[model samples]
Target: MIRAKTILALLSLAAPAVAGDIPLAPPIDCTLGETCFIQNYVDRDPGPGAADFACGGLTYDGHKGTDFALPTEADMARGVSVLSVAPGTVKATRDGMPDIAMDRPGAPALDGRDCGNGVVVSHGEGWETQYCHLREGSVAVRKGMRVAKGTVLGQVGLSGRTEFPHVHLSVRRDGRVVDPFDPASGPATCGRAAAAPLWQNPLPYAPGGLVGAGFSTTVPGFDAVKAGLASPATLPAGAPALVLWAHAFGGRAGDAVAFEIDGPGGARIFEHRATLDRAQVRFFRAAGRRPPAGGWPDGAYRGTAQLMRGDEVLGQRTVTLRIGG
Candidate 1:
């Protein structure tokens, strides 16, 4: 028998004019190399503080939207488009803001314009959605344009108050915030689920996971990552160091972190292990070395990172890069 949620999704696609119920798909394709993660959810806490649908520390105080973060600044540079979750007419749009990550020391302050290059769509009957932190020139739709589910609205960016590259999506009804994960509109108590879910298939939120992983010939800063102002990927033979780094979120004390690097010959060139002494929202680690008196061999190189709790692995990522012409 077909599930009711599946039928609802089909109905939303077939009848875009329908009001009151709009099914949502992922705003960005995570299957692509753009392995994005949810940094925050609409604050469910009522008392002027913060809380996520899962009641985790993944969210910050007063965060009123769902944040989908790209792995690195380089990924933002390559461009990843954000999609509309449902059909609607564009109500408003803001563009031309520079894609500047706030992590830089001298980054300009946006102040009141924190949404930064955004698009809003009204789904009728007071229902609306907002997509923010879009690339300067990536807005594809203008005000009053009819857009369907999965329509490309803009590219994910680091344009607003965000220190990382991401797109923040906000859903509202009559100007009041709504938690799509909790349709019944109650606190998301641990192990106690809401009676109703707004989403046909709610996006899963993983608290602790690898946020970014990549390789470089030179050590990169939190911003100089591929998505930032990092060095070229093509490494000359005998370069100083062929570094592999990984950044993560939701790390806790006692967790084991591991790193590995393999060269063109498929040989493990370097490996290291470490333990976390405290929790962190953003964690970074790397492994590399200068070439022997000779230099690096010409070919592709691979890097892998893992986070383990006891013997079980909590998160992991692998990335590859080409060396030489």
Candidate 2:
């Protein structure tokens, strides 16, 4: 494991000859204690991060807080139990208050429903953490309350500005929401429990690896399929038969995966396709696991899935199967 002091020492050295260990970036004051993540892979911004979320197909003021997820599903639902990112005071809380809702399915707009049934914990030095999208009528604390880390803020849900159920975790400073994506672009507000630092690429750490960033689905080194069937136990006519399922391990809230499904005949069924999110988990089950909703007839089929970067393919794998009655 790489130590923080070594990283700092490298930063202090004149100029190292190592490839990835050079000193060019600025020094960031990373918190060595508490850490924070998006809960899902694509918890910040858009692109590969938002691939695994069913809500990714939608938009919100060109700014998406947590990744697209549906945390209230039966499979991979249930978002992370809201907690205090750091020691702070509850600045506000709302219960039974009507929140802003999305008008359409693809675009984002403004709604007064800020932090749906949520809380704002204020930290020292003008720092703060936000626990939004809480379960309706489940709030415990009131405004002006104090809380510590690991404190149960509320239950996760798909509240305001969301299409599916998920948590909307964010950090703020002096009333301004801070970016949790690029750690180098800002200061360290909390320590990370997943990765060593909070700024590491959130995709690779996603429940599954970054879609379009690495191999879409890993090929289990040898040969075998886990989780959902690649060809599925069955499929409907005209519907894409070749499908693959992936789940992120330790994935952040905003990470995404990009891949495509292909038929055994080499026909592309799902090009640049991606799974959906339901908050912290990266499993495709969050988006309704119905490869062929009505169930497909018996048949022989095969398919492949891969991650990509625009036109560049990263990781990939093949899935084969035979549908029987």
In candidate 1, residue 87 scores what lDDT?
A: 87
**What are the Cα lDDT values of the candidates?**
0.74, 0.40
lDDT by residue for model 2 over 171-268, one digit each (tens)?
A: 55565554443322222223322212222222222222222111222233211221112234544454543335443323333434444444445554
lDDT of 1 at 133: 94
Task: Write the residue-wise lDDT of candidate 1 on 111-178 in tens digits.
Answer: 78899899999988778999999988999999999999899999998787787788898988888887
**TM values, all candidates:** 0.77, 0.46
lDDT, residue 253, candidate 1: 86
